[model samples]
Target: MQYQLRVSGNLYKELQQHLFPGDGKEAVAVALCGRYERDGISILLVHELMLIPHKECYRAEDVVCWKTETILPFLEKASKKDMAILKIHSHPGGFPAFSDVDDESDKDLFSSVFGWCESDSVHGSAVMLPEGRIFGRVITPKLESFPFDKVSVAGDEIKVWEHNTSSYSPDDFAVRTAQAFGEGTYSKLRRLKVGVVGCSGTGSPTIEQLKRLGIGELVLIDPDEVEHKNLNRILNTTREDANLRRLKTEVLSSHIRETGLGTKVVAYPFNLYDSPEALQELITCDIIFGCVDSVDGRHLISQLTNFYLIPYFDQGVKLDADGKGGIDKVSGTVHFIQPGSSSLLSRGQYTRQILFDECLRRQDPVEYSKRLKAGYVHNADVDRPAVISINMQISSMAINEFLNRLHSFKNEPARNYAQVSMDYSDGSICNVAEDDLPVDDYQVMWAGRGDLSTFLRMIELSAVKV
Candidate 1:
């Protein structure tokens, strides 16, 4: 089976710091991870990482040898969760390949660790060059091995190293899109597997644009049914459908299939974070458009994008009311979250406190209600007014941003606008206010941080069994 390893930027940064401390000596890094299965391929997501002190090593300058005391504990911890283990060490000599010492080490280590833990879970070893490029491989208990097809690190910018494939030609249908962004852009769109979370105001419109642009496949996630009030903003929704309480995803799924555009659609009428089975489908997507409203929902997408090494575009709309029944503040934000770049958290779009409050509400309505009544916590707007026009405007901008990313059609660098915020009342849009990508040496923080050490507090109880 083919394998791919994803490391979160935080862990990657940790690895770099530990292995290349200014002291200038090789170090050891170990990560305990779980598997994401897609089409029989196992994608390892490193959840927790630890740096073993080099003093635990008993080798000379050019070689690395870890003490059994340090190695046994990591293996035992990994075996407890049936998780895979990745052993990594740096190569200051600029060799990306495993050295003879590494081969001898793995032959002895991989062979004994499994016996010690009685684990059939896959274990692998990797070599990281001084420049931070990683070449990883999966090893069998029998000592057989295969190189990892690619490695991904997710942070403010997503970095990927996939096996090469020939470029494709755009079809006749993409003529207009090709004219606008060059033919090369169309090829990128066709090979993409995009995910749209939430099929309401913003999500529906975002989906509408992606389909017409000749995207190859889509995964739609929404746990809502059409309501009478939603008809005004949700595209492709009808009166009859609203009256029947038809699932929003089903409505969109039917439309895409009817177009016969060869765009595959998988609709899940469930919250993305609450459905592990559905989350699996998302691992295959190249990009995700987060169009949900809740802070909790956004939090999940923000983390998922990093772990899966998938770029994400998250758009949100907010309206503030003036007690006097007049227009007050109308604003929305379109943030293009690339892996290995500055993240939403770093941007301050949503805070840890907001996520905490939202989770409390979802888990316990009574306590949340009591807290709200006592003014112990602030609540988000439950019935914010929404208009199709503004939704369309923001959605269009987000889609345009997506195009800009793949084609860089604009004269200025795309990074210039890491985030674009608009004030509808003021009729102004600008991306300069927000901080751009950070230059931290650890840009790879969660570049590929996959499944959490434990199911996220809110997601654990909610993940529906397949």
Candidate 2:
């Protein structure tokens, strides 16, 4: 099984501060983690962090020891919640690999942790360098350790570190892209597994760009089939696809395979709300691009990404045409959501009332229609105008947002552009920072609660186990 660890950028910053503290000695900390294990993939999502006080440990440049009792409370909590434990420490001297001393310390510490927790789950030990880059390993129940295959930090900028950096020789189609972003960034793209929700309009173009840019793997989720109306906006779709009523995911997956770029694709022809298996597949993605139009779909993806500590990019387009045939408004928005920080809900992308109404409309359409007629719910069924040019523009912006987060080529920091708004009618654009957005207490309460008994804490999902 491939083992991985994910930490929110906010928590990673906290760990860095406590671990470094401008000292020339090592320091220790403990992290309580929620886990997701399926299909030979195991991930640890850090839920909470506890820093051992410097005064409580004997510190040196290469070695630091703390009392085992300091972590008993956290261990008890982990046992109660079925969570895993991760022991993290700092290397003040910029050591790249785990030392022999670290191996000995981890063996002893995890042995006690496995015994105390009394569960058949894996634990981890990590080391952070002065530059805030982290690497770690997972320890099996037998106390045998294997290096983490991947370690990712979900923040304003998506940062990922892999145990092995596989060599890449770009094909003819990707040679130009490699030159534009540098070979290192291109190599990173080849290692990333991205998920795209929704396959029409924005999602099609988003998937096209990702595959051409050499994404290693893609998980495509959408329940709809190709209708004639989608031919105008969806890329690579033909009249035959529309007539055949082909699944959007299937069409996209086939196109990617035909490109011969070696980008693996897994298509799920099912709605995100009703499929627990799709949710499990989505969590395996390093980054998510949410191109769905429904408020409920966006809301669900926001919750799932936060739970798994994955960075998310959500984009939508709005076209308002005056009944007289004149264009009144044309606009689009792309929101970049970081785990443990401001979310789409907190950013006012949708209100709780709207989310509730949408969910009702999906679960009980007859009741929703009756409520709509009674003026108890908003009428959200109006068909909006869509143009390929507008969709492509917004899709490019969203993909560029993802690229900037990976390579950081923008003049301003990624954190400053939590939301990007493009007004095509006005010919203007705007960016909003994360600090400017409001926070929702409810979203905060659920952040990093991975693999809960109920998926996303939604009762309906509990019935369908992954």
Which candidate should be chosen as best, given TM-score against the real structure?
2
Error of 1 at 228 (Å): 3.0
lDDT of 1: 0.76
> Which residues of candidate 1, in runs, are more than 4 Å off?
7-34, 37-39, 46-118, 123-137, 146-167, 179-184, 323-325, 338-346, 351-353, 410-414, 432-449, 457-466
Residue-wise C-alpha lDDT for candidate 2, range 1-466, written one tens digit per residue: 9999999888888899999988789999999998988889999999898999999999999999999898899899889988999999999999999999999999899889988887898999999999988999999999888999999999887889999988688878889988888888899999999999999989999999999999999999999999998899989999999999999999989999998899999989999987878898899999999999899999989999998999999999999989887779999999998888888887878898999999999999999999999999998788888999999999999999999988888999998999999998889999999889986666566667788778778886886463
Which 10-residue window in model 2 sums to the lowest lDDT? Answer: 439-448
Q: What TM-score, computed on C-alpha atoms, does each candidate reach?
A: 0.74, 0.98
For all candidates in order, the CA lDDT equals 0.76, 0.91
The positional error of residue 44 in candidate 2, measured at the CA in angstroms, is: 0.6
RMSD of each: 5.5, 1.2
At residue 269, candidate 2 shows an lDDT of 96
lDDT for each residue of candidate 1 in 364-419, tens digit (9 for 90 to 100): 88998898899877787477878899899999999988887676767776667678
Instruction: List the pairs of residues colliding in candidate 2.
Output: none
